[model samples]
Target chain A: MAVYTQVSAEALAGLLSGYDLGDALSFKGIAEGVQNSNYLLETSRGRFILTLYEHLVDHAALPWFLALTTHFADAGLPVPRPVRDRQGEALQTLLGRPAAIIEFVSGVSVSTPTPAQAQAAGAALGRLHGSAPGFGKARENDLGQPHWPAMAARCLEGAAAIDPQLPALIEAGLRATRDWPAGLPTTEVHTDLFPDNVLMLGDTVTGLIDFYFAATDLVAYDYAVTHAAWCFSADGRDHDPALASALAAGHAGTRGLSADEIAALPQLGVGAALRFTLTRTHDWLNTPADALVTRKDPMAFARRLAWYLKATPNMVLGR
Target chain B: MAVYTQVSAEALAGLLSGYDLGDALSFKGIAEGVQNSNYLLETSRGRFILTLYEHLVDHAALPWFLALTTHFADAGLPVPRPVRDRQGEALQTLLGRPAAIIEFVSGVSVSTPTPAQAQAAGAALGRLHGSAPGFGKARENDLGQPHWPAMAARCLEGAAAIDPQLPALIEAGLRATRDWPAGLPTTEVHTDLFPDNVLMLGDTVTGLIDFYFAATDLVAYDYAVTHAAWCFSADGRDHDPALASALAAGHAGTRGLSADEIAALPQLGVGAALRFTLTRTHDWLNTPADALVTRKDPMAFARRLAWYLKATPNMVLGR
Candidate 1:
């Protein structure tokens, strides 16, 4: 939501000299991709997003992210394919930071998506999962169940300041995820497929963006993350049954879920909730008071975890 | 730059329904304006910038700003004209904020401007001053000479924290402007014409933007402000004689300065430097450490003021 780096016109021209994109016509710093500085770059050729990777991005995993998005694009997903320069390089250095240009995908990201949009987003995620087998890359889900205990401990140290109920809710969330299952299904999952990551046009998923959090993880866990993200109210206090049922049906229609995967939905949902809770709690506690970014409330996910602790598989998957 | 407000897709759609620009093909939060939320909005008609007025702006004076830009556009300057709705309204409320769409002007703002570009910028400023007499509107220059003493007093309180010498330098700058010349040429001037405000392609100036500070003021004061903005090194430690001479020659080439405006160059230059020094000092001492905006060094303009305090009219105006 902020441009951390200022790109000069001379530096931009130097960067564009390597590409076939004609003389730069217009360039603007865009407030997107929190971890990187993005510019809406328009050249004689076409519109593209010029991204300068910031410190938060893992430089070693840069190729993997590009390859994953390229794989998705090849499979006909509306992903922004990294544009290669004349020397066939997608990544290079500009202003002492790794930079790349990607095709600009046009679509609106709805904040409060309608049920039809939610179904379309689910279908898009299912397609993403369906296409993962063709790509020959895998990364561990660092935020998965095995890491939750330490994350919970770090958050618990200062969780009292954010909310007095946070420590107890986190402990309860940890207890609920004790039976975290494995081996049901595996795929490269977009672990952060909130509604904002999915672009929509009239209930159709036109683009699935922000693959920075993609990693090899449980299919049910990925589904659980999406369910938790989409089926809840903004405050995360209440669930929308209509949206949940439509989303589940949409995902199931694209790829059939086995009985084991379906049965594990409730526990995976709890784990998903706890994962976000711990991370948000940590962010809320650590983020500087004057940071331009608005810190998302950890209690939102804490409430989601509370709901998932008592929710049955039918309530989760809407079976 | 940062986006202070997030406009949802629904709200954007609702906004577009008022105009005939057709559905929004794409909308992105742009890091352009410091005082407002600007979005690069694309539709079937053309590209435009949708600006949502924020707290720093005076709501009552918005129509005046819009009308002034419209007046500039009408006078053939490369200013973005406000787009009107079916009912001929450019200013409206979106998400409880005043918002409007302006025509998108194309060109890049150079950080290290060439001497030729500096001359062109001066010519653009000259054209702006030349075009002003035709327009029938006047607003007090809120950031002009009259406002500096109070601004300097406020900045002096905490100037030591920034630099020990700043307070003395501010006092000296105040003394230099104590006999500030009056009864000079006056017009509607863009009081803040930094390099970023003037967009260019090669030596040709295509756009003169950011008129938030435009008000009726001495024509020489405006020139002095621009001269201070463009003819100095990034650190303000050194001046570019070629750039200074070219900028003055260019402006004079377009609109000849009187002997009084020419002789007042040194004093007005000192005043301009002091004005920016005070503002930047106030911002530096007051801006929260966690604020996303980088607080510009007030010392940069302090150094400029120091130079102007000793510089002769020939050194400043390149006689």
Candidate 2:
């Protein structure tokens, strides 16, 4: 939620000359994406979001992200379509960084979503998965199981400072997921569909954003991540079971979870909680003290991990 | 260029219900104003800027600021008009702070202005002064001459850390402005018409923003402030004399400067440089180490002061 890079007017004008977009009327650095500098660009053509990929984001993976979003938009999903320049390039270089002008998707991201909204979000996720099979280019989930132990170890190093009991709980979660259900419906999954990433217009899920984390992963695991994100309260200790049930019902209506997928939901839920807790913990500890972006509380996901430890598949299914 | 407050979707929806602006389609925190939290809000009606007044702003003085812009917009000036609610009140409370929905003005703010752009900006400033006589309300410039010495003293306390020569330079500037000319063509002045506050469409000045610093002061002083703002280069030492002359000519074309006002230009320019240097010095010294907004270099204005020290009124008038 900070614009790290400053784009000059002359530089922006030079970049826009290659495009059909009319002369730049207004350009403002906006507090939107965390890993990129976003400008709310208005031209004679229309309003668009000009994004400059920051160092934190892997430049090599940008084309894949852009392609996935283009595919989703082409499939009629409410995703931001990358605008191509006159030379027919959607992704190009600007200020020596990979940049793109994206059609601005309109909708407000709800911090606290209602059950109906959560269900709609789940249905949208199902639709997103349904549209992904034809996208041949694949990217590995960098923050997946292979990276979890290392993140957990890093968190454990400073766990006592955050919460004395956090390390033990994280260790237990790792032990529980050691032989987690293997090869259960691999598909393109939005691994970070937190409430902030899902845009809402009343009860309808109008848009899903931040596909930078999208990768080929277990279809059930994607639902599990959303469950943890939408169902849990701000503190993460409590969750609305009805919201979880609604989300499952919504996904089932579209994709219909298999028996193995259904059985693996609880384990996936625990893994999902662990994933976020470790990442948030790392971010909370490492974010520069003076950075304008606020570090999210890791304890919220810590409490979610605690709840998932006692949760069963039946509990998640609201049986 | 920072959003200090976060307004939730529910709170925003509740606020918009009081207005006729339909529903919010998109709302994003934009990096615009430094003193307030500004959001680029797109509603069913049109695009608007939502500003939440931070603690630094005096709430009592808000109506005056709103009315001044309203007056300017009413008189065909390119200023953002404060949108009134159903009850015809532009000033309202949102999220426990004084907030307003301002009509979004088009055009980009230029960091470096061309001579033509500077002239247009100066003409706009003159137009702003010309429209001010009937505005009944008057607010004193809080950062005016009376406060300069105190601010300079504060800056002097920590000046050595920034630059060893800064204290002597600031002290010299203070002594030079001690018996400065007073009571020369007083009117409502946009005390801080820095290049960033003036918006330009090509060579034409399309908008004037951030009127929070608007107050009753010497109209010549306003021009001096702008001269210092628009004429200086990035390093602040080198200035385009032709740009200064163009700005003076543009202002003279709108509301002719009096003989005494013309004579006092050099002194006012030095004072203007000192005023900004002191405040910016204070801000630079006190800004939190990890703050997202980068502090403006005070040395830039200090260099402006150095230039103003040797400047004569004729030098500013291009005679």
Candidate 3:
């Protein structure tokens, strides 16, 4: 949540010159998304989010991401579509960085979501999976299980320093998530459907956002990611069974889960936990001390991994 | 430039319950305003800025600041007024910090301001001085000339570390601004009227904001602060003669500076430069490395002080 690139008023005016968005009225940097520099840009026409892709984002894959979001938005899902210019370009360059103006989806992202909100968010994720059957593009899940060992290796030394037991926990996580359950239902999945990514009004989901980490993956695994994010407390030490049950039921109600998918919840949950734990560990070690970014604690997800290791399929499903 | 406090959605909802602003449609942490946590809050009624006072702010002086802004806003000068709750209390507490909702003024703060923009900004400052006559509340200029020695002492070692010449320059600055000009006009001044603090729409001043540093001080001193901020380059090395002349003329056109105030511009300019230099230096040395803040370069204002020490009234007033 930082504004890495500073866009000047003149530059913004120059950028908007290509489009029919009209003259700039108010522009303020938004501290929301982690990976990109976001600015809440308001013009004579309307309010929109102007995102400047930071160094971390792969420029080559940006078009695919935008297309996926467009697909979701076209399917009547609560997703922000990249606004195209008069030149029919959704992707443009600004301040020497790839930039795009996105539709401003109005809603609040709940930090501590209630059971009803969790259910709504879960339904939104299921709807996203159901909406993207016609999207022809496919991006590999680079952060999938096969990549765990390399991520673990890079994090081993730093993880050991944070806690002596952390290194062992990570190693066990890698071992526990080894066997892949073949022949599962696959779809265009929002690989990172955390609660924070869902925007809600009361008990209804208004916007499902931050689709940058999206790819064609197992629908059940996407459900597992959402489950891991919402059902547990911030520190990942406490579980809310009610929230978990609500979330699973909401997803199941929208898109019926197979018996195999339901039974595989515990294993998928382990994979999700380990995936986050590794990323957080890498970020904690590598992110500079002075960067205007918050480093999520690696231990939070590490604790979640531990919980998932001991959990049964019935326990994870809240049955 | 950072969100120090994270207000949960529930906490925000609870805070909004006391107001007639209706339900929060969107809330995002704004990456602006260094001293406080700012959020762009949009409700069913309208958009507003929710500010949470950080540790740096004096809680006691908050009401006075709010009153001062309300005073300016009431005069229809494009200043945002504090939106009071149903209890008629502007100052409320949320997440264990003093909080208030302010009207969202629509305009972009220019990074590289044009000469016309500088004049408009100056005219706005002059209007602020003209507008307030019966404002009973008074705030001492704690960051005035008297505070320079202590600020310099605290920054001595660090200043020397930044440059061997910095300490000497700071010492010389204190001596140059020693003899305060007497019998000058005093008014409630926006003591920190930097270019970033002034919002504009096509060279017309739309919002004169960030009045936390407002105090009863020499009107010329406030003019000097705005001059030092706008009429020079960001590094404070290259002075813009056209911009300086335009700014002085703009202020003079509105309020008509006395001969004494005009002559005192050079000295007041030096004082203004030093005040900012010392504060920036203190922040540079003291702010933690991990802070989600952009620490401004102290040398920028120090260069302005150096130029001001050598400048004449004619050069400053663009005669």
For model 2, residues A133-163, the per-residue Cα lDDT tens digits are 8887778999887778888888788877888
Estimate, for each residue in A1-319, the C-alpha lDDT of model 3 and write its tens digit: 8888988898999999999999999999988878899999999888899999988888888999999999999999999889999999899999899999998888888888888888888778778877877897888888887889998998898888877778988998889888977899887888887877888889999888888888878888888888899999999999789898888778877785789998888888889999999999899899898876778988888888999899987778766
Question: Against the correct fold, how does model 3 do in TM-score?
Answer: 0.97
Q: Is the docking of candidate 2 incorrect, acceptable, medium or high quality?
A: medium
Query: Sorted by TM-score, highest first, which candidate order results?
Result: 2, 3, 1
Residue pairs with clashing backbones, model 2: A290-B290
List where candidate 1 sits over 4 angstroms from the true fold: none
lDDT digits (tens) for residues B1-319 of candidate 2:
7888899898899999999999989989998777899999999899999999998888889999999999999999999999999999999898799999999988888877878888898899889888888787778989887778888877798987887778888998889889867667777779999888987889888889999989988888888898888887877878888898888888888886889988888888889999988888898899889766688988898898888888888887756
Which pairs of residues have clashing backbones in candidate 1?
none
TM-score of 2: 0.98
lDDT of 3 by residue, B130-177 (tens): 986668667789898788888889887889877677788898899998
What lDDT is obtained when candidate 1 is compared to the true structure? 0.89
lDDT: which is higher, 1 or 3?
1
lDDT of each structure? Answer: 0.89, 0.86, 0.88
For residues B120-222, what per-residue lDDT tens digits would candidate 1 score against the true structure?
Answer: 9988889889999878788988888888898888879899889899999999999999887988989899989999998887788888888888888999999
RMSD per candidate (Å) reads 1.7, 1.4, 1.6
Candidate rank order under DockQ? 3, 2, 1
